[model samples]
Target: MRKFTEEVKPSRAVFVKWPLGHPFGEPFKVRQHNAVIRKAFEALKTIKKPGTIIDLPFRWRRDEDWEDKN
Candidate 1:
């Protein structure tokens, strides 16, 4: 994680809740998907400066979900 952070060096980062092969939270599940995105954005809103790493209150079903798209 540290290495990747160093590579990208982003000002802020966002993590979401979902599952492997279902980043958007199951197909057609707009409500759940939106909730995940909203949570991430909510965490972002609390950041008042750069270099913030919000852990997010939610967690994806699996790390593989990180690469999933809908």
Candidate 2:
């Protein structure tokens, strides 16, 4: 994680606690996923300086909504 962060060198980074294949949210829950993205962007926009790490205030539910169909 540190290596990737160093390589990118972004002004800020938002880390979501979702799984690998599901970076956004459950498959079909586009609205929910997009909402999360928008919130992250909002946090980034508020940063006046660089080198900020904003852990998003969101979490993916492990209920039936996010069940692995495979």
Candidate 3:
């Protein structure tokens, strides 16, 4: 939906390149969920331009454990 977001031009957005439905990461993975949320909040606080989409750094299925990192 990044293309849609670009076309629609929302006020602000946080773009995570995960699966279509799992916008906040896999179910029950609280750490991953919280990380996405925190990024969204961070975008909300720092995004200065309209229609700005901050592409999140998280990957869909990485090898490393997310809980071990910040």
| Residue-by-residue lDDT tens digits, candidate 1, 1-70 | 4445546867776643334456446677566577667656666677778776665444544434333432
Off by over 4 Å in 1: 1-6, 17-22, 59-70
Ranking by lDDT: 3, 2, 1
The predicted structure with the larger lDDT, 2 or 3, is 3
**How displaced is residue 7 in candidate 1, in Å?**
3.8
lDDT of 3 by residue, 6-67 (tens): 99898889988888998888888888888878878888879999889998778887625455
Clashing pairs in 3: none
Top TM-score model: 3
**Judged by lDDT against the true structure, how good is candidate 1?**
0.57
Poorest lDDT segment (10 consecutive residues) of candidate 3 = 61-70
Better-scoring candidate (TM-score), 1 or 3? 3
lDDT of 1 at 19: 45
TM-score ranking from best to worst? 3, 2, 1
